[model samples]
Structures are given as C-alpha cells and as structure tokens.
Target: DLAAAPGVGVDRPRSPQPLVTAAPRADLVIWAPPDVAAALRPRAEDFGRTRGVSVTVESVSDVRSALQDVTAPESGPDVFLGPHTWLGEMEQQRVISRVTLSRNQQRRLAPKALAGARYDGQLWGVPYAIANLALVRNTDLAPQAPQTYEQLIANGRRLKAEGKVNRILLQSTGSTGDVYSGYPYLRAYGGGIFAKTPNGQYSPGRLVLDSPASLEGARRLAELGREGVIQPDVDNTNAVPLFGDRHGAYLVTGAWSVPVIQASGVPYAISPLPALPRGGKPVPLLDVDLFYVSATAQSPKLAQEFVRDCATRRDVQVRLARATGLPPALTAAYRDVAARDHHYAAWFDAGRDGDPVPSVPAMQAVWGPLGQAFADIVAGKDPQHSLTAAARQISSDLP
Candidate 1:
C-alpha cells in the first residue's frame, strides 16, 4: 500500500526548486482530454503572448497512461490537465512537482478548490473547475422537488404504481457497482469510506467501511435492492437515456449529464438531494479538474507561469467551465458563470455541501472492494457479511 510504503503519504514538503527566469526557449506542451483540449486550443496562444513562448494543446485519450509517461525523460507533455485524484499517486511516483501559489493567487481560489489541489500537506496543482452530483428531477413528471428522501421514494413509488414512470430513481450502480454514484445513498445511512480527522481531512490511518454505521448503510442498500429501487442492471450507459425518456423520475448525476438532458428536451430541475428521514445527509463527492506541472519539464518555471497566471485568470476559467459544463474553481470566475447559468450555480452549491473525494494513494485500495461490497448487497448477499469482508480485504490490501 502506498500509504504505508515509505515516502507516499508522508507530510514531507520538498522545496519547489523554482527555476530562474530565463528567455523562453522550447515550446511548452500541455496534454488534456479531447474536450478540454478543444476549449484550450483557441486560448493557447494567449497564454504565451507575453512570455515569448508558444503553447501547444494536445488531445490525449487516456490521462492515466499519459501521466505514467511523465516519468520517462522527454516522452510526455510538460503539463498534464487532469483530475485532482491523481495528486497522491503522481506525487508518490515523483512524476509531478508542487505548485507554488502566491498568497494573493491562493486567496482568489475557493477554499475547497485550493484544498483539493493539495495532497500530503502541499499544493501540487492549479485547479480550474469543480464537479459534483445533484438530484436531477424531470419537472414535468415530479412537478415539485421532494422535500425529503421519504417523499422522493414515496412519490416515485406512487408514480410507478400509476404507470407514470417505470423506475423509482435513475442512479447508476451497474453490474460492478459504482461507489461514486451510489455514495449519496450510502451517506444517507451514515456510511462513509474513510474517517475524517477533527480538521476535516481524510485520515488514511482510519478505514470506516465496516463500522456499525456503515453496516447499517449496507443494510439500507440491500433494502433498496430488495424493493427494486436501485438495480444492478442500470448503469451510466443507460441511466441518462432512461431518465431522459421519462422512464425514471429522478437522476442522481453530475453536470456531464446536462448536455444529454438538454438534447432530450426534458424540463428538468437540479437541486441537492433531499434530507434523509433517519439522520444522515446525502452529500455527494466533489471532483476537481486541475493542471499539474511535470517534474521533468524542460521549462518548469514557464509551465508554472502559464498555470498560475494565464489559466487561473477569471476569463480563462469561466470559458473552461462553460465548455466543460462544470463550475469554475476561481471564486470570481464561479460568480461570473453562476450569474449566467443557474444550472452551474446548482452544481456549485452541491459541491460546497459535499466532501472532496479522498486523494490519498490509500484511496486506491477502497474503490474495488467497497464497490464489490455494494454490488453484493444489491445482489441479495447479507449486508453485514459483505461489508465486513470488504473492510477486511481493504485492510489486508493496505500497507
């Protein structure tokens, strides 16, 4: 396990050997997913206008593999545009360098956005956008958003009984289980994958998946399965269509589903998940998109300059947020985008109420086991046994 392995999760901050300012020499290359690359293409030249360097945006299909190539000398892009979740592993592998943000620059970003850009007690990237799941309701069918989880379930059941809808809620669990999409439900029952310290940071030393509260959450999952409210067959590939076609009344999804929902021409409303009748809050996981400087970049300072100065500009972040259908990370940029689109504001608000997905390398051990535990519970297995087994497996797998 990377956490227990020496040097992975340790809070040892290495000085960011900042390069001396020099004349721009080589062109800086940035690798991003196709959609993001498209959005940056037109703005790439603007980033280098005053630096006397050219910026090139390259489309990469798989960011994971691209990140791996950063370790090979002269084989990868000088900068990587990807998710904040990669921070732990990249920092551990020594493929990425820490980002040095000035006090003023740090002040310009949202606290959560800045926090998400850091791992192992150091900032490692410049975050540009934030994304999180929200309760998406087909307004025509549901009319009004439910005030509580019980009301959501009761309303869906009534609609199903009346032949108005075929499914209760359209959340994607799939055959393998998706802990990301299923998290709100688990959280509603007081289950969490990791325990948080008093400071509110995830503690790798504490794995809470098998605690009494989590087991109770697992039981709730099984109950939902038995009632056919959540199914092992429904997944991301079809959940949007099912919801868009009016087969489901509500969908627990992120902004990625927006374009499809809009194309379907459905009158929909986005809001926070309703309160649970019991106690737990249905807070979704926050996912931040960031631009990380490569440790082996030929022009490290130039790369940092671009990310810190150009990319973090309010105008630049707003454009990226619009293209991605996510909320900008910059506090000022978010306000500008939120004013223009209320859907963006809804997602931004949801992220504010959510927790950042744990970025520790230890999180790598949680997904598979926890996901299987959820899948088994949904497949008729005993919740207590499945959860206990999953926790045991995760413990054994952790260093």
Candidate 2:
C-alpha cells in the first residue's frame, strides 16, 4: 500500500541522504580487560578531541564472556581490546567487521601482528601488542642461555645428574604437551599444523603437521621422555611451580609467565628459542593483542575512525607497550621501545622467527587430537603411528 503513496516510487526512496548518513557521531564505549584498562582509558579524551565522541571505559571481568553477545548494541562494546585469537570465533558470529586499511596504513604494522587477526584476506582487527613463546632461562642455575636444543638438554642433564634439580627443562603444557608451547620443536623439523602457499597464505585444506617431517619432530619429544629429562606426567601440572621454585633451569614459555618467574626470586634472562642442531630454527607461537570494532556499534563510523586514527597513534601505542611491557605491533612504536629495552627487543626478534597461528575456524581441529598424539609419543607410543592417527582424526573432523 505504501508503494502507491503520493510522490513515492517502487524502485526509489524519497531521499537517499539519510541512508548515506545513517551512522552519526555518537559516544563510544570501549570494553577492555582489567590489566589494560589503564592503558586504554587515557585515550578517551584523545578520541573525543579527534572524533568529537566521548568515550566510556568499561572494565571487562572476563574478556571472552563479555564479548559473547556482541550483536547486542546496548550491551556490547563500540570497540573491544582483547587477544587476536578471538577474531575467528567473533567473525563467525558476525559480531565484528573487518576494519579496512589503506596501503600506507598496512605498512605501519608488523606483518605477523596483522596476520594474527587477518582471515580470508581481510584484516579484521587492529593489532596493538604481540606476545610469543620464547626461552626463559634461570640465570642463577644456568649461567648461559642455551644456543641450541642440544645445549638446553645438556645443561638440564648435568643439573639433574648433579642432584641440583629434579627436572632438566620445564615447560607448562597440557597432558599431551601444549601444541602452542611445543610448536617451536615441531617447527624445528619443518612441520606445522597448516601449510602455506608461496605468498604465505594458509591453505587449511593442506595440513602439514602430520607429514613425515612432523614424525621426526614427534620423535624428538619422545626422546625427552625416554632420556628421563622429563617424565611423561611432569609437563602440565608442575612446570610453573617447579620453574618458580628453582627446580627448572630452563623454561620454554611466553611473557605471560614472566611475573611468576620474577616473583620466585630467580635471576633470569629472556632469549629466543634455541636453533636446532641440524641447521633448523625453533619457531614459537606469536599471539597479538588487538582492538576490534563491534558490528552492532551505534556510531560505527566514529568507532572505526577512532581505531584507525587515535588508537594506533604512536603515542598511544607506545604508552600501551610501556604499561604492559608487551611488544607493540606498530612498527614505529616497537622501534622506539626496542631501542630503550633489551627484554622487549629479544621478544620482538623471537616473534619474527615464527609464523602466525592460522586464524581459520578449522584450526580448532589441530588442538585436541594433535595434543593427545604428542602426549602418546612421550608416553612410549610410536611417534610415527601416533602422529599418523592424529592427522587422520584432524582430517575427519574437517568438512
């Protein structure tokens, strides 16, 4: 009936300007985890000055739970500052939209940082910080950092032999060894969960983690258990406490474990994961911290403009790094901190040695089955058979 109204047409509306300008400038609410709330709260004024939109900083108790219903504008954030790994799940829910960047803008960020949130060729989140796994050695127990995996185990063996420590090396992992923590060893043998094309795009359809090369990596892990360097059950439960209590001379983990290590009163040094003895390099897991825009944002345009302009500003990014001591993702911001801090510089270099974790939804398949296989390997199962079974399980799980 309205199609026949006077001065109205079936194919056209009376005015197109409203549709073009539907998203007006409005206040913004940024939801952030407690640790980084102070880092982002100060930007409220900056966003106001630049985008003419006041910002309210809300403390998120649980980052994942807080973002679960992001399609509801009244409750969800205009923007969210959290881990980049959430991008896949969020995008699948259609709760977040890709924040397109220009060529020059893309150049400002580190490639891996961008890759963590990038999926299907779209940069869905604007990255701010990077955290990756590396070798954290207790300088008190081991005066020098290990230059190779061989060196690391050698030191641990001597310490255990000397009755100075119970475990040679300590790494926090799940029962089967955490894939994230064990990735460096797996990568050392030219194996990983996903294969990449020449251009470095992940072809999830072509998984490489269960390939023959991966079997070699699995054998190495099994060797650790057979040599008594680490017991089959020693991995997940006690690594953090053991490392903190001076029971572990060498630890393979990320910055997230640094504070507990420090509080233990142990002298430590941060270094990249060791190079493989056979001309290979261990690649650690690199996780990015990102700022995401909600699709349900009332001021969608202003939210994007704030993320693009104010949030990525060098000053803001630098302050974020200083507050958290995490490496900044902005290339310029990282350079500034790397010049001033040795610890931060080591982490930056370590991340460069590793590849980004695939952000595809199917990446979920690589975890449980693969982790169980790695556990079985260390428990005296045949590495080749265990890995083969895990790969078959992964393939079956995928469409």
Candidate 3:
C-alpha cells in the first residue's frame, strides 16, 4: 500500500536497498487497493526517481488492515487512500490530520465531491474519483430509457407481455449498495432518510417508506421481480453479475462496471435514473472517496503536500481516470483525453446533477433499517408496516 501514495519520492540513493533492508524504511508510505497500487507503482517510481528520494512499496491486503497499520505507531503510513467516509470515523477518533485546500484547488472540484471530504469543518482527504448510479438499458431490447418512474413501469409491463425480459436490475447486496441504488427512488417520491436539527442532531425524517409514492415504487419493483423480469438469484451474491451477463434489460449501476460491460461486449446506453412518480427529478446517490493524512505520521507537511499533488496534479488524475474509469474529481482533469473518449461520459454527466450521499455520522443509522425495509417489502411484506418498523428502528439507532 505504500506504493499508492501520490508524489512519494523515489529518487534517493539506495532505493532498492529499502526493499532488501531487514526493516523497510521510506520517505513516504501509502495505502490503497491492489489494482490502484498496480497502476500507481511505476508512475510513483518515476516521480521518485526524478526527485531523488528513496521510496518503498508495500501492499496491504484490505482497507481495514491498511487503516490499522497506518494508525499504529511503528508502521503508520504518511498518507492513506480510501473512501471519504473513513474521514468521519477517523476524525472522530482524532486519527487523521486536517488538510486545508487553496481556494483555487477547491474550486476545481465538483461541489458534492468537495462536500464529502469535509468533516468537522476541515477537509480530511483529497478526492481522486467520484461515482454515482446510472440507468443502463439495452438499446436493442428497449430503444429508449424510461423518462419517469411511471414510464419505466409501463415499459416493463410491455416488455414482459412480449416476453423480452424478466426483471429490472436494482442492487441489494448490502446496506451500502442498496442505499446507493434504492434511495433515488425513495427521494423521487418525496421521502428522505434523515432530517437535520438546528443543534446538528439528525432526526428521522418522515418515514415515507410506506407512503403512496414509496409503495408505488416498491410495488413496481416487486412486480418486476415477481413476474420473472429479474433473475431469481438476485438476492445478494449475483445481482450485478446478472446484469453484466445480460440477463436483464435495465440496471442501476455505477461507472465501476465499465470494464465488465466493455469486456462483455454488451451494447448499452446510459441515462439518469427515471423521474419519480410525482414528476420530481430522480437524484442518484453519489459516492466520493478521498485521500487523508494520518495525524501520527512523521511529517504532516509532507503528507499534505502529497495529497495536494494527488488532488491537483494532471498526470495523477489522468492515471486515476485510466485505472478506475471513474470521473476525475477535478474539473480540469474531467477534460482529459482519456475521460473524453470513455463511453461512460454520459453517466458522469448525469452524475454531475445527482445528490451526494449523506456524510454525517448519524447517516450510518439509515442503512440497516432501510435495507431490511426494502428487502421485506420485496419479499411481500406489507409496505406500510415494513417501512414503519424500519423507521422506528432507524430513529432508535441514530446518534
């Protein structure tokens, strides 16, 4: 994971010595995913060589382990790369250092993306990428993506009558994926997950899970699932794969699936989530991941410099775009040649107008009840009862 830190110096003498040393030592260390590490290592080496700094590359297995090592006194990294949500927990624990962005640098980022990095009035991380849900449709099967919730249902019924498909794809693997994909529908129907009070506490918003609009939405979704419009195995293990395999005509997915979709050679088009039943716009849930500095690091200055380099540097942003297929967090990088040619550009455009997922600490409470509520409703439980029960649970769980 040390290799994942942006602007890690590699040019110092005995660079290879660190790798062979009994105990590895380096000017900087980073934590990130394997694929991101693989893509970043060579470039980082190049940057290090140019600057004459010796850097060591170490790969940590997962986010949790990486965070643990980075927070440990002896093994901590100078920089950590992961989701911005980590900031909420890390900041609350006083494990991360605050980063102050220049006005211009902040201006270059999407507003919602920037908001995700801000926790407790300080920006904790530099965002590398931003993603959100998009409606993907097989143009061959359905010439046009639905423009509204009603239209989507109508199209589903027509296609089912003709025996073209079985289910519309909505991810429900866990609380996170379910909320990301399902909240748009709930919001479109004029429901919200939480309400913020003047004192900064979050209250349970109107539990509209069983409202006419939510019921209408869930019923449509359940109808699709029941009529065989969706695959029977869509419980959790393989809903995404079902869509990737072309078992369904429509899916709500993020840009992360670009590689799989391309490899599958499936002909598809992207559109924003359909509008809600009352004609309100559908607001896709946007997820932003950010880079953060560890407070215990040897050099907070160096860590902040590295984050700034990662956040604003064109080369780093371009490589990030190439590696992840996610839109670069910076406006200037969005115009890079690589991003321009990617077929997912329309989805990124759609995401520009979407809503950021709630980032407050209290936001965590919304996950469990919402997931169970949706699952229960889909399993044929009474919608109003299911939603009311979930809301009560959520209210009790909120901080």
Best by lDDT: 1
Candidate 3 per-residue lDDT, tens place, 330-393, comes to 7777778334675547767778676566655555666667766666655556767767787778
Least accurate 10 contiguous residues by lDDT in model 1 = 6-15
- Cα displacement (Å) at residue 128, model 1: 0.9
Best of the candidates, TM-score: 1
* Cα RMSDs, all models: 6.5, 11.0, 6.9
Q: lDDT score, residue 394, model 3? A: 70
Candidate scoring better on lDDT of 1 and 3: 1
As for candidate 1, its clashing pairs are none
Q: What is the lDDT of candidate 1?
A: 0.78
Query: On residues 279-346, what C-alpha lDDT tens digit does candidate 1 reach at each position?
Result: 75777788788999988887788888888887788888888998888889999999998898898888
lDDT value, residue 223 of candidate 2: 82
Model 3 — TM-score against the truth? 0.82
Clashing pairs in 2: none
Off by over 4 Å in 1: 1-26, 69-72
lDDT of 2 by residue, 1-399 (tens): 001211111111111111111134338877776667677778766778675557776666555555653445666678878766566766887878889777787899988888887877788889999888777888878888788878988888888888888888776544655666656767787988888888787898997877877766777877876876646565544676688888878877666666677788888888888777666677877778888898898778877987888777888888888877789999999989888988888888777867776666676677778767766777778888887888899899874
lDDT of 1 at 97: 88
Residue 253, candidate 1: Cα error in Å is 0.9
Assess every candidate by TM-score: 0.90, 0.89, 0.82
